[model samples]
Target: MRRVVQYSTGNVGQHSLRAIIGRPDLELVGVHAADPAKVGRDAAELCGLTEPTGIVATDDVDALIALAPDCVVYTALGETRPMEALSEMSALLAAGINVVGTSMVWLVTPRQADDWLRVPLEQACAAGNSSLYVNGIDPGFSGDTAVHAALSLVTRAASITVQEIFDYGNYDDYEYTGTAMGFGNTADAERPLTFRPGVIATIFGGLVRNLAAHLDVELDDIRERYEPWYSDQHIECRMTTIEPGQLAAVKFSVEGVRGGDTVITVEHVNRLTSKAAPDWEFPPDGQSGVHKVVVEGEPRIEMSTSLSHPALDVTEAGCLSTAARAVNAIDWVCRSPAGLVALEDIPPTELIRGVMW
Candidate 1:
């Protein structure tokens, strides 16, 4: 059994904590909670578990390192404070702890990451002989792993597109939705951090480049396009309120161009409500969220994956999948070499372990 430490207790972290506790092959050794209120509380209380796991959350990094778990499931918020997150992860790696995480989306393809961002992580892994795997739902399974699996079915390939269509009504991250995404701001206001020039490319471009590398396709450039949808009426969302004429939704694409043609694309259509953008893409009938991959080639394959939980809504289920992707890969990551590990490096069978029958 692998000893595991769960970091953070946010939307994704809560799910990670629960998954660690539920897995019989994994032992919940410790938890590092970011919120002061969460510190000193039982891990079970933080993740809605009825029975206590006998592990209390702590804020002391040194104490967690002292425990020396086999792996750490890190789901902390890295978008706003990437440097800090990197430092934290590097510290853990330097302490010889394997890590699988959803933070630092750019690290989804560490090989293609900027040298400055990649160097420290590489050094940490080298110093401690540990491995790090970073992934999540969109920039992770749907955009790369699942897309590659679909491409294997095509006889010939022309253009490939991976899309995430979701209604964000239930997404309750106010800092992310309100500020980072610019959901409730005026349409004409300065572009949000997510849509700023080169931002999408920096975040999702690694997935495109990774795909290009796997296909042996050289991309001349990576391009980005952003479109915002304005609300026609006042709408109250879980995160923030959208007034009439305010930004309600956004559709953006990051395209990998090869030989002057768009070869690979990562696109997203995110709306506060399904009614916000009738023209933009939506989940399949009766669904609220989906990750779709469209391969325009000889076979013209289109694969759509929708996730839902009996107890949680579609958005929360999606968050759960993000956590599961990281948590499930713990064993594979621990067995891998002492550097950055990608999804392609780990066999599919290794990730399917411990799933319910």
Candidate 2:
């Protein structure tokens, strides 16, 4: 069995903690939480699990690293503090602990990552003989592994389009809905950094570039576009309230250009309400969320995936999947050579069977 340490107790971290405790092949060793309230709490209680696991959450990164478990599931938010996240990841890797999580979206394609971000990680991994992998739902399974699987059945492909259409109403996080996403803000309000130019490129550009690499094609450039929809009337939900004409939905797209034609595209249709943007296509499943990848080519294929666990709604299921992807990869990453790896570098089926096999 692999010994595992969980980092953070946020949306994904909580799920990781639960998964680690439930897996017979994994032994929960430690858990780290940045929030003061979560520190010293039982791991099971933090994740809503049925029984207590003796493991208490702590804030000391040094203590967590000292565990030197087989892997550290780092699910802390990196969007607000990328450098700090990198530093922590480096420290864990240098401590000889395999690292896997959703913290760094750009590391989904490690080779394509910038030197400033990649070198320290590589050096650390080499020094400690450890490995690091970053992944999540959109930039992870639906982006590379699943898409590549779909492409394998095709002989030729001209373009690939992947999308995440999700309704934010089901997610009960006010900070995410109102502040981070700028949901209730007016159109004149300064745009959220998430919508700024190159931000999409900074976050998901690797998926486009990685797809090109997978297909043995070259990209001319990667481009980003953003569009927002305003609510027509005041609306209140479980999370936050939105005034009429306030930002209700946002669509972000990243495209990879090849020979003047768009060859790869990734889009996110995030809305506070299912009906917020009638023009933008909602999930065909009619569920709270749906992820689709379309290939415009000889076979012209389309793959639609959804999440609905017995006890999880679409939003919670999404977080669980993100945690599952990273947690399940722990064994594979720990057994592999010391370095940064990508989804394409590992057996995708491990995501299905987990560490059971």
Candidate 3:
């Protein structure tokens, strides 16, 4: 069994802990937690497991690294702290610890990342002779491999569009709901991160660029579109409520265009409730959350994914999928060459489903 350490206890990180423990080939060595309440707690309890594991959570980064575990599942948040994540990953790599995590989703297609950040990470990998792989639901299975499989049946390629449509009301994170996404704010307020100029390019544009590269197409320009929908009436959720005329829904799209035609695109239609945006695109079953990919080509293929766990709700299950994506890739990353590993670099068979069935 490969010795492993989990780097955080967030929603995804906790799920990753459970995954690592259940894996037949992995041994849980230690866990890291930044929250004062979580530190010193048993890893199993922190992850909501019924029993305790000997492993306890700690805030000491150096001490955890000193354990010399085979890999670190660094599922800590990175969207708001890209440089900090890069620095941490670089140091871990330089220490010869292989890393596979969901923090930097764009690293699934590393070529699309900024050169400045990429250079130091590459150098660190070389120095320590350790590898790093990053992935999540959107930039991982739901976007890249799914789209790649759908496009294989087509003889002619026209366009590709990948979308994530979900309700964000149950997501109780104050920073993400109020500040980053403007979920409970008024319609006139400044748009959220998805709508902000260049933000999409910085975060998810990697999907578009990577798809274009896979298709061997040169994009003329990468364009973005944002539309925020307001609720006419009050909407209630488990955590917070959306008052009348508040920002209830948002639609964001990034397209890879070539000579006026869209070849690759990534889109999201997110709302606080299903009632908030009745007319927005949804799965045939009208599910509130789904990741969809459409190939507007010869076969005109379309595929959608909806994830659920027995103990978790739809949104929480989505978080688990993100964690599973990273956890499942841990062994492969640890065995790979020391450098940035892209989605294409790994064999598709390596991503087989686990005990989740």
Candidate 4:
């Protein structure tokens, strides 16, 4: 069995945790958490997973590496200290362990920054005879792969837009609503761009950039805008009423240039009322939306994704769908030309569905 180590303590980590469960081909090896209190606790329990299963969370990353797992799945929040976290991931890959992660604004490979984060890691992985891939539920599935799939048939494509609206009205889970998107008072507002410096090249930014690169068009320009949700009157949500305050409804957008020099656009938004912005043209998932992707072309392609989970921003179905693509593509990256790669680098037919049902 292939041993996989995971290093995330929240929703992203949850994706990895659920991915490894009950899989005979892969073994759940070790888990790493930042909280000292969580250290030494069984990972399954930390995740509210019943049955001690013998896998424990450890604070000692070095020790975890010493265990020499074949691969590490990193899902830690990459915003606070992305470079540092990436450095740690690089070390593990250098130590000869294949690495997979989703700690970015978008995809992490095919970077353009002068330092270009993934290069050194790829070089290290190659040196150590390992491989690395950065995967995210949205950026990987709904945005990039989905867009790539759509663009495939366009002989004279004009533009593409993607949306993933989530209805969180029924979301009874606090962690799912609050922290999945950092929804405190100033969370949705204009705050200092502290982490994820390459916000454009991160998340959908990189995918947008990659698309432009694939089209062989010079990047026209990139811009980011935000919308704050404010309720004039107290709005009732389940048991609680939300007062007037600005939490973000939209985070960022990238406007690209096509070969015709026409502008192509890709955007990411957090939450918004479907009724609030009828003028925006962007589709709203429903009440308390979680994930939404809208793609527009010469004609148009609109896909609305909704998942049902009692207590998470992304449903189990969403995570499973995304992870299955990443997990099954492991062999593709292993065999492909070594370097930073985007979804466009691989064939869409390679998508690994958990089952044919």
Instruction: Give candidate 1 misplaced runs (Cα > 4 Å).
Output: none
Model 4 lDDT tens row, 305-338: 5555576544445655555555655545655654
Regions of model 4 farther than 4 Å from truth: 113-116, 167-190, 194-204, 235-242, 258-262, 272-299, 309-325, 331-341, 346-350, 353-357
TM-score of 4: 0.79
lDDT of each: 0.90, 0.86, 0.84, 0.59
Candidate 1 lDDT score relative to the true structure: 0.90
Could you arrange the candidates by lDDT from highest to lowest? 1, 2, 3, 4
Candidate 3: pairs in clash: none
What's the CA error at residue 252 for candidate 4, in Å? 3.8
- The candidate 2 region of ten consecutive residues with least summed lDDT is 348-357
Which model is ahead, 1 or 2, in terms of TM-score? Answer: 1
Let me know the TM-score candidate 3 reaches against the reference structure.
Answer: 0.96
Best-fitting candidate, scored by TM-score: 1
The deviation in Å at residue 307 for candidate 1 is 0.6
RMSD (Å) per prediction: 1.1, 1.6, 1.7, 4.3
TM-score of candidate 2 on Cα atoms, chains taken together: 0.96
lDDT at position 118, candidate 2: 96
Model 1 over residues 1-357: C-alpha lDDT tens digits?
A: 999999998999999999999989999999999789999999999999999989999999999999999999999998798899989999999999999999988888889899878999999999999999998898899977789889999989999999999998888887765577788788668888888998988888888988999998899999999988898898887868888998888889899998899999999988987779888767888688899999999899999999978899888998999998999899989999999988889889898887663
Residues forming the 10-long window of minimal summed lDDT in candidate 3: 172-181
Error of 1 at 168 (Å): 0.6
Clashes of 3: 0
